[model samples]
Target: MANVLIIGAGGVGQVVAHKCAQVPEVFEKITLASRTKSKCDKIAEMLPRKIDTAQVDADHVGEMVALIEKVKPDMVINVALPYQDLHIMDACLETGVHYLDTANYEPPEEAKFEYKWQWAYHEKFEKAGLMALLGSGFDPGVTSVFTAYAKKHHFDRIKTLDILDCNAGDHGLPFATNFNPEINIREITANGRYWENGEWVTTKPMEEKRVFDFPEGIGEKDIYLLYHEELESLSKHLPEIERARFWMTFSPNYLKHLEVLQNVGMTSIEPIEFQGQEIAPIQFLKALLPDPASLGPLTKGKTCIGNIIRGSKDGQEKIYYVYNICDHQECYKEVQSQAISYTTGVPAMIGAKMMLEGKWMKPGVWNMEQMDPDPFMADLNQYGLPWQETWLDKPFR
Candidate 1:
């Protein structure tokens, strides 16, 4: 058992706290901290086991380091914003504690996000004899682990990979996002990219569309190809992959709202004068939108996300797909969160459990795929998010 500290109070953070409390054997003690102390206290109140709560600005390394020292947690699970990733990592390094986060680092002024910044800390973590796990959430987390499992058990060489993420949940509110409004809007409005033939290919936002028939009666939905951070690490870790792409399902209604917002410049990150004050249009728009955390009770439907790989095994070409389907209502019934947060949060707890058990403890920064997938796969079944596999005759592309 280990004492764990969670940083963040959003939907994902709430789910992470609840899930961690459920497994006392792995997490002997847990503390949930965030910029808002009430949010952390509220989430802690719902857990089956007692959990401590505190208020700290994750963006301030000094504050975070001080809190870490006070709590003396064995590990810190960062479910905070991408902008605070480096600060939390720095604090972890200072205190010689393990670090894990769901997303990669993205600059506050720029919408651009990449793994290079976090990957640069490999040597620092190694030197400090501490471990840092990057992208342990759903897409970059479970999806990456799915690819590694395929490579280990089914494929001799993986050449192509297509990661399909479908969120069929409806939050009742017409314009609310399933996660942080600013982060969600920025990610969708940015230029799309994919890896192919040793180079990055760019496209206009939501320009490339395809329809995928999801498994388990999830039906068909329109998916748009986008550049995700997972492609970078997957390409580097799996050299045999010649082409890699990430696609996400978007409803027509959602696209229409996004288009209107884009046309009115409401999605722009640039600051403009408003009422004699400078304000970012996108940030203003986020204020107008409903918070993702409040949608759990109203959200309904499911999310299907997984990886499809094409490779060769024993001189024979093979195609395999591994995925998980999570229902929002079911997730809410279990953990009082929608499927998006539940999907991401469950894996965060599992990864922490692996580290606490010393199954994946190492002194270096590592991606999810670098660790053994067997224990993770088993944990998926034991936990809330269960997965399934199927052999396809050909790639979805």
Candidate 2:
């Protein structure tokens, strides 16, 4: 059993709290905190079991450190924004607590989402004998584990990896992001990139597109290449992979609204003079959009995210695809959240379990694939997100 202090009360955070509460034997105590205390209290009220609530600005290291010192949790689960990752990690280190997060750290001024900033703390965490598990969400989390599971059980040598994320759900809104609008828009508008041979190949945003026949009836949707943080970690950990790419599907209506926003400068991150104050256009636009948490009840359909790995098993080339399909309504009925948050939150909770249970505990900064995947794969079936795998004779692309 462990006392977990979870920061951030967004959709993903709410799901994490609910899932963790479900497994009382593992999570003995839960404390949910965010900048908005009411949001934390709201989530705590929804759960049958009691969960402590607090208000702390995750961007401030002093406040986070104070909270850690007060609660002194065994670990901290960071579901806050990517910008606050380093601060939370610092707090964890100072208080002698382990750390885990769904996303990697990105500097506030730029939109880059690489793992270098977090990976730099490997030695410090190792010296302190504290473990930090990075990127425990859907694409970076489950997809990484799926690759490792494939490598251990299905392949002798892996050559290629394609992480496909498809969200076929509709929230009955004209245009709204499934997650944070700022992060979602910033990622899509940035240049598309993929790793091949040895180096990165960059292209115009959404420049390359392919139609993928998704399994479990999600069906043919257009997937576009994007540089996800997992590509860097996978390329480093799985050196045999010659080509690695990340793709996400978007609707035509989303593209149309995105184009209009870009044309009108609503998506730009650069600050502009506005009535004697400087503000980023994208931040302003985020306020005008609907909160992603509100879409839980309205969202309908399913999301299919997985990995397609190709390599040799017995001196002959082979292909395997492992993925999970989540229904939005099903998730809401269970956790009062949509599938996107459920998918990400379930893995976050499971990863925490792996660390707390010592199945994946090691004194260093590590990605999901670096650890043994058997226990995680089993937990996925037990805790909501059951996955399936299939052998492929033909190539996906």
Residue-by-residue lDDT tens digits, candidate 1, 1-397: 8999999999999999999999999899999999999999999889998999999999999999999999999999999999999999999999989999999999988999799999999999999999999999998899999999999999999999999999988887778889998889899999999999999999999999999999888898999998898999999998789999999999999999999999999999999998999999999998998888889999988999999999999999999999999999999999898999999999999999999899999999999999999999999999988999999976787
Backbone atom clashes (below 3 Å) for every candidate: 0, 0
Cα distance off (Å), candidate 2, residue 258? 0.3
Provide TM-scores for the models: 0.99, 0.99
Candidate 2 residue-wise lDDT, 1-397, digit = tens: 8999999999999999999999999999999999999999999999979999999999899999999988889999999999999999998998899999999999988989899999999999999999999999988899999999999999999999999999999999999999999999999999998889989999999999999989888889999998899999999999899999999999999999999999999999999999999999999999999999999999999999999999998898999999999999999999999999999999999999999999999998999999999999999999999999998889777
Error of 1 at 264 (Å): 0.9
Candidate topping lDDT: 2
Off-target runs (Cα >4 Å) in candidate 2 are none
Clashing pairs in 1: none
